[model samples]
Target: MMQTLPTLKKVTTTALVLLGLLTASCKTTPATQSPAQGALVSAQDSHIAYQGRIGHAGPDAAELYWSGTTIRLNFEGTTVKAWLKDESGDNYYNVIVDGDSLHLLRPDTTRRAYTLTYNLPEGKHTLELFKRTEYDRGKTQFYGFELGSDTKLLPPPAPQKRRIEFYGNSITAGYAVEDNSGKDQPDSTYTNHYLSYAALTARHFSAASHVICKSGIGVMVSWFPYTMPEIFDRLNPALPESKWDFTKYKPDIVVINLLQNDSWLVKRPEHDEFKRVFGTTPPSQEFIVNAYRSFVQQIRAKYPDAQIICMLGNMDITREGSPWPGYVQQAVAGMHDTKIHTLVVPYKNTPGHPDRQEQQQLANSLIRFIESNISW
Candidate 1:
């Protein structure tokens, strides 16, 4: 028998527990609850649909990297629990139950079962666990899900025909998008890549997206020790040898949102990244163009037929009169590839990362561009 769900104001035992900030639900099973009370489902089962660059940690565990890596499944039960592990223990996930994403789930650093929701009316329900943190937050291992006795996994959701890939930095990673206070500093608490222009744009097109991004990465340089070039082809950004097999998943459209970090770092030669990439002097326009051009060539080599959008912006880099967009245009022009075009979203102008509203604005722009130019 199921207990009655508590109203927003009602408090009750047997409550549903959400990760990170605790929220109450009726008959919520605690993470510390014994899994022996439920039936286990391996994450590798065909009924689970994972969309992103995922490698395997073990025979039963799925290794997740990148910002928008997602794990989705359908099941029959009154409750659901996810068994997951995080390297840094700082990652956040959007737990969508039956299409309603009212919970933000944060997994423990070590493997454990987290009750995503519980005590629901007995029936069918859909579960989508959308990763919200970027790779720097650290990798995660999904062991699978735990369901109530007599409940079983259902067929996975149909895959989307349109596949999209985004290579970018903080803006594309959706850093601070949830921080509307306009503070320039950001933390994982306010970062949500799913709300970023890249992921939102993919959702708009009903496309499956692979978001290869870091908060401070750039084409030529990055705030971190690595840059986009070093990790773009990697299945795990943390592992250099983990090269992604391009033949596995192909995107019909590719978007590159970068250069924002490079623009800022170059202005400060004293910064470690600037000194490492370009010591003592700022890189010339030709240098920037060539670097950008080389990265595009790499992408073109990997996805010969995929249309590439050499993008910049929604940052000060794309502010009026900035030469960054011109550099992107120059690089694309020299390549002379009709399939490759340049786009720069208007600078958000306000300080800090673009909030949810601002990200939506950027997504709206990209969606319109795709609608006007690309078909399919």
Candidate 2:
């Protein structure tokens, strides 16, 4: 029997949360240099900018679980500090300072303020903390930022005119993209969503983006208990009832890269998910095609005019002889919608999840596709 998930709640036993953080390895440590004296900015500060479907735990805390969730603030100061709480002590982040390349940061389970950046040149600077791990790693809370004396927070950065949202699996989440070992799976600390193709493509077009995806999820079934279709519109991934307000963030373009897991999972009749979804038999050609098409139609119903790109992988599912791309094609053809399109990133023959370099290559292919087709 499937276990019932609790309603997404704002509060939990602080002890268990703290214990989870305290249980991390001794190597996991927070930055020791906190601002001795300055203002403790509230997470509710108007000057701060946020992206992703974040849920709030309190008036001054933002709970973020999805990859690519970001909190940005501009301030003029010599030293900057931030207070972050890691739910499971497994999440990683990309600390992008002043739009620089990026510095990897792993916040310890501690609740104290961390000195994010300090001793910068005397001028205004931007600090963006980007979540690099998928939701399964656990939720993180953003308490606020702190700035030393003789500093003030600047106005929010200008919003991007272009907006894009991605729906995909491990590739889109940048899962294990940094690991090169031949292991079946690797640590979550190596995952970096900031370097994913979806993030790269959005940056190329200066589009604000939201990634609503989980690893192992497919349109029809997933390796886990839930599929993307059941969780796509949720504000809280674990809570089916915590629906996201689509009106708040409508994308000009939406990209759907699924079916990869289903392509392989459907063939495994003995797999638990397969047995639950299609007992004793594999999904037929028509069932598979219609399953994908129906999900796309669900998205269309939410965004009436957004261009939808039905994409396959840089994985085995997009191999030369793979029928996955054809399924997407047939689905789009059946939709009869001009805004809906299909494309496939050529298969990457690399082992495990595509490494960093391979992810860049996939991003380039997708960029080229969008350039050739979408005018934006």
TM-score of each: 0.89, 0.89
- Per-residue CA lDDT of model 2 for 243-335, tens digit only, reads 899999999999999888999899899899999999998999999999999999999999998999998889999889998899899999998
lDDT of 1 by residue, 1-376 (tens): 2222222221233335663221222232333333333556676666779999889986778998888998888877777777777899788887777765456677767566777777766777788888988887888998777776657666779999999999988888889887767785567878888789998899888899998888888888888778888989999888899899999899999999889988888899889888888889899999999999999999999999999998877879989999999999999999989999888899888877888888999999999898999887
Worst 10 residues of 2 by lDDT: 14-23
Q: Per-model C-alpha lDDT, please?
A: 0.81, 0.80
User: Which pairs of residues have clashing backbones in candidate 2?
Assistant: none
In terms of TM-score, the best-performing candidate is: 1
